[model samples]
Target: MKLRKWAMGLLAAGLLTAGLSAGSPREAYAESKQIEVSFSPVHFIFGGEELDPPEGQRAFLYKDSTYVPLRFASYALGKAVDWDPDTYTVTVREPKAEEKVSIDAYIEERKAGDRPILPVDASALQPITIDAYFEKVNYVFGKRTVQPPAELPGIIIDGSLYVPLRFVSESAGNKLEWDGETYAITGVSTAEGAKPYDEIVLEAEQAFQELVSGFTSEFYVLKSEYDGADDAGREEVLLQGARKLLEGQETFRSEILETLKAKLKAGNYYEGAVDQLAAQFEDKKQGVINLVTLFTGKDLTPYLEKAEKELEGK
Candidate 1:
């Protein structure tokens, strides 16, 4: 594993000779006698980017080699480091994912003209090998650039790129913020405010009046026409009106049954009137559903939920 890492550094150096270096690495040969453990200030660079180091620390230097600090170096490069007492093992972990919207889904939504779901530019996204994300640390997103934190600050763990989550979020145009008190992470809202889920849904008890009213009206109207051909286009018109009335209906849910519900709300005797209206409205719903099924060649019964949802915030 050490040899492989060492080879990677050399490969980076080889790229350097060809003007291909983003802190690809090379190791130096050294002897203990020629080393200097000093308080002398020195600035570090990974690729072309500078690294800030702590004061008065040893650089593990020999005449030909220099050693860098791991914890600070990794942190500077947006990686976290941990030490385990059980096995004396050190581990590095990647940053948390900002959001679950996939690149493919983002592209699809963009193509569909929907609101942008992800925060990335999509055009500037670059795919890097795990080694590159870890080893190079420096990167560019479209026109934006990142400078490497320190000398080749990354590790190869099982051949997966574990770049900072910030990189993905930045590539996708997602904004990130830290909560200092709770140490929590948050992504900026894609929408303005929270969804009014409560109004979007009606509990059983709350829905009783509206549901029974809408359903009962449709019922009796069809019953009246049971002995005759549903010729009066009145039923179709009422059903369509009823459907539209329920769409995003919180502010005006009872609009279709407005007069009926108003009477009920006002404690007026209105049972017969509402049932008669609903019965007449039945023909309207049937005609539309039949034609829609014929044209689409599928059961639009599934669309009841859709129609309801469409009116969710309207």
Candidate 2:
């Protein structure tokens, strides 16, 4: 099939949409309270490891309470944060462990268009405004509406919401301690028998990389054979090589999935991590499809479909 036919299928599935919707605009505020606060050089340690806040974002001190960027802190600690402009509410939730992915990676992917990562210089004490009209804005953790103590009310700086450190840590079911002398804040997850998330991801990713390396070596050998073949002989070489490649693809995919599931059963893997493996697998599959198309001048989709049916029948 032509590529446009595939795109039409995507449209029928609602997998494609027109230009993205611009969300509701924030309400204008006439009454506002301006207050001065000092940005402190406070370090953050989460799950026993220190996380460097994105450059230009800092923890600030106000009324003896320390405030950090709302989305940054929540995300680093494996929580989800969302803002609803229509209701002026910020909701943070501890998504189930199995559903949790590395939010840090997700943030990096969307950093270019996100708000919290926007450029700012919060190196010293600066004046910030609290719009009276936004006083009724809600902060929710799970299903509970969080009413921060008057001494530590939420503040906005440079278009980013800032919430008290203690509030964020405890809400995410983590314990927090401040080292006044060192200007460091350490947060430890309070969940019993919680696995080390970063360590698990590192181990799984290393194994996946090794698999890809081996597959790449085999792929190059097949490419060499195909290139050296004459026009008439190329089809036979491609067909024979494609069988081995497809078999290896299925085998590697099954092995990697099994390993990932084992880790998940041990409470150490997030389901979303599987996407990394799937993406790499699909890239290799597409490369094989492209090579077939280049040599035969025909759509490989039907051949791939026939191969699928054969494999299924077997």
Candidate 3:
């Protein structure tokens, strides 16, 4: 395949150049450093005009710039690339021959019609070599702009470029399920799993409601006392309400902590978990202030004044 040839050629060129270099062979080798390859000029079109390959890939234009790794391009084209390591070769096969169309043609056709061209959906494909696919796509679509570490384990398999499953799955709004015996992921959501994403958002909203409810109840009790509505009786009510509200806040915090702990124990630290927690905390604090204002029927100037000190102690 043209793509595979280009990859092999680049590899061969690097090896050959390194072998012939005199001093500082690593520094002497040019392509040893990361380089870019562009698909736009070679294959992409926008507004009926050919888009240029990105600058980095253009530098390598002298040496088969059009070549793309068969596996990577095939996957991008929504085809599957099967490899036989024993035979040291790859086989590119489309799911259905009736779907035979180059990526450029596919995109152009979509652009000409009412429908938008969605990314190739490869969720159903079986696992293959992720590394090979990664290298191919990274070299092609990535324009070779970044250099993946050479010694990473596992090949980019299936149609989805295999990344750290934890990061990719969570980002894609999917959960990772681990089977101890086989270590396979079975519960991955396809692109169509908008419901899971919606559920997560809804749960977040409910959590905020719980946090605000307690704060609102406490604020009303505090205001009644400030307004001179039987100080002694109101004090007793305020203290009880404050205690309950504080407990509610603590419970919410505990829920967040428990979720984090579970993720950590499961060996999946989601990237956004910390940020989400912090945002929730801030939202709860603001809710408390808003509730206080509503209860007092006046500006919460005194409480806001002491907020900094209270936060410092916290």
Candidate 4:
């Protein structure tokens, strides 16, 4: 779907500002009670326009420590950022569309690197070494310098990582403008783009249907297994859950079919719809598996019957 007119304007402005920062490596970092580190943002030009931010964009601060949502920044900037719970490192990268980037890239780069000059005041805070943090969270940051143990800070808030907004915007060939009054950051790409709305709606419908069907098949399998079991109460509870799934499936099916009919009447081609549906189906397969596991207390094999039957008809 094409971004709304206002959103496009914001993106364009954001990209232009981002492009100007290409000369020098901008220092994007967060100040926390424990430590401070430097980093850069990933940039990209997608379909000749910058992509929008990912969901859940927020900023936070605690005990004078600032926390920025890394996912939104990375997703919006078209960069790859991953957290390793095993190590407390935040991996940030400028990933190409076709490249297979991994979270380990940051750690490898940093390990083969040098320690950075630590700030004087930051030296007094409790030492929360990145290596120690990584051991706690299984995550690592990209190449950067760190101070010695004596100058380290204590208690790192590894939950929310921060970055300079300008770094991400400029790197993506866009501009970032902050509205002080509204506290909103507006990112403007350099160009315009669009996706078919009807197509998206149709695809969403198909995905909803498939998810329902999968759940239904899994529900039946569990029901069959528990049919002659001695735990009558448990069986009743399972049956109720199955009924809910069935009702949900019917509702989802009706919604999708109605939406498709409407789009078809409006002269929308089914190609986009089909493409979206296929994508969604592929994406949601894991989610379906997770759900089945939760309720069935078994593997996903139980849900295969309904999906197989549906596919055969297709």
Candidate 5:
């Protein structure tokens, strides 16, 4: 997507239209477009996959606000959902132990490596709040208005607003914690994060560069092994190293997501170039992975899946 057009189009088409605060910067277009209601095409993506709502629960724009069915969201995220009879409340809970994939061994293994291995700062990624009914004030105005984080936008139940905790954040692997005292959802996130835009661009660039370099080095070794292997040994060593590289590639991608989040901070009008660069970086990396798989003609996916599951808890 063209960064500038995508930003403005979404913002202008009801996803944005932010209201100005009492004493904030006033731009003519922003002021005129406030409360502009327009229909938008929306989709909810979790675990790097897009989800579909049950039959009639398609996402739609109304009153300059986006809305989605609560039940549909919970089901898509693997989160448990319930409704209260008297209190008129809908409840959701995140899985206790969601990902079985372990990061410890990877960390320990990296300690002996030359350059310092930078673990993604999970604390930095903010949770995107979902709601049954949204008050435009929270999402609009000078606040990060570019992207509203409306995966399953707010829905209204009997005039009260509620946000479902399903699919917290795929990019950050965010989790929700219930506070017994306040009865609110909160907790530690297991995803990457960035500080400000400038810092994010710098961090993202560094992380991406390192990942590419690592992939290049591993690819060279894999190619070398493939060239030298006899037919009898080709499937053995060649496929094994290829599988390992794919698994490690996932780790690198996750590590870089935080930097991308910061680099793609919503509502920052001066970041079109950064946005374009980030998207291009993703395409290039994916192209390399595709080529690796195509050249090998070996389905190394099963290995990645097995490692992601059985290798955990070891």
Candidate 6:
């Protein structure tokens, strides 16, 4: 690899390119002359939770920039971090819906390793590799592009890439702060906070209660009108109430149930949480159906089914 070009890439765009020496990489590059680096014990807090670095990896000081393990940092921010050995490319992006399980597994799998660091001395310069570019995925634009960070290039120590901590955290929309005395880095994620399961269930119950109260009030008015009307006019009054109930059912299905489902999916909710919420939604819908039957003195099962089918087609 062209060392000058790679060094320039890191300075401007945070891309670190490097050349791999022949034979076993660690052994072959041990004798190369480079800059001196030091290791410091740095603490990391992400999204209100403390994150411990994997064994045998750490944040180190290089020319005043705090360099963190690239994969670990990206994963802490809830992004999918990947390393391609064949192409020597690192990719960072939003995890796909289907990748949630695999990502969790990967995190657990990376908790252990042994990468011995060379002792700091006059002749020791940390082996730096400037031979990788980051490909950032943007799901909103539906594009996969190689977009380097706008600051310093990353360094490769042992087998891992170390990137500037501030750049990674800010790029992920996190508020980062450092404590000089304690040697700690803390960050707050800007992603939407997950709604509690109880809160979601309570909201659903309240909305369903309101719908029931409004429908009952409208039904009473219709009953009063029917009682005063001639037999020919009474039929129309009952039909109006039935139409209103069916419309209310559709709104409850789309607005309340579906909206809740979307919110649950967006957050880091578990599968059991979604299933429980779904059960409550079904209970609420059935209660509405029963209320409609009692008020109109006619079963609305067929009408509700037909309306749902029409909605699905649309």
The top-ranked prediction according to TM-score is 2
Clashes of each: 19, 0, 11, 45, 9, 7
The reply for model 6, stretches above 4 Å from the true place, is 1-33, 84-88, 105-151, 193-314
- lDDT tens string, model 1, 1-314? 13466555544443332112135344422111211222222233322233443333223222212233443333333333443222323344343453123322322332322222233243343333222223333343323333323432223232222223333333323344543332223433322342221121122224444554664465455434432545455344334434543442432335544644443334322133345345545554565456445543445455555556656756
Q: What is the lDDT of candidate 4?
A: 0.40
The lDDT values for all models are 0.36, 0.58, 0.38, 0.40, 0.41, 0.55
- The positional error of residue 12 in candidate 4, measured at the CA in angstroms, is 14
Give me the displacement of residue 51 in model 5, in angstroms: 39
Question: Which runs in model 5 stand beyond 4 Å of their true positions?
Answer: 1-195, 253-255, 258-286
Runs off by more than 4 Å, candidate 2: 1-22, 26-31, 96-99, 106-135, 193-314
Please report, as a residue range, the 10-residue window in candidate 2 with the lowest summed lDDT: 13-22
TM for every model, in the order presented, reads 0.20, 0.44, 0.32, 0.25, 0.31, 0.39
Candidate number with the higher TM-score (5 or 6): 6
* Candidate 3 vs. true structure, TM-score: 0.32
Cα RMSDs of all predictions? 22.5, 20.0, 18.6, 19.1, 20.5, 17.2
Q: What is the per-residue lDDT of model 6 for residues 145-238, given as tens digits with 9 covering 90 to 100? A: 3233444556545444567776665444345777766566777544366664335545765776687678768877877897788877866665
Question: Model 5 — which ten-residue stretch has the worst lDDT?
Answer: 16-25
lDDT of 2: 0.58
Worst 10 residues of 6 by lDDT: 21-30
| Winner on lDDT (2 vs 3) | 2
What is the model-wide C-alpha lDDT for candidate 5? 0.41
lDDT of 3 by residue, 225-313 (tens): 65775757655544444455555656666775455434433433233544665577777666665665576444444534454355468
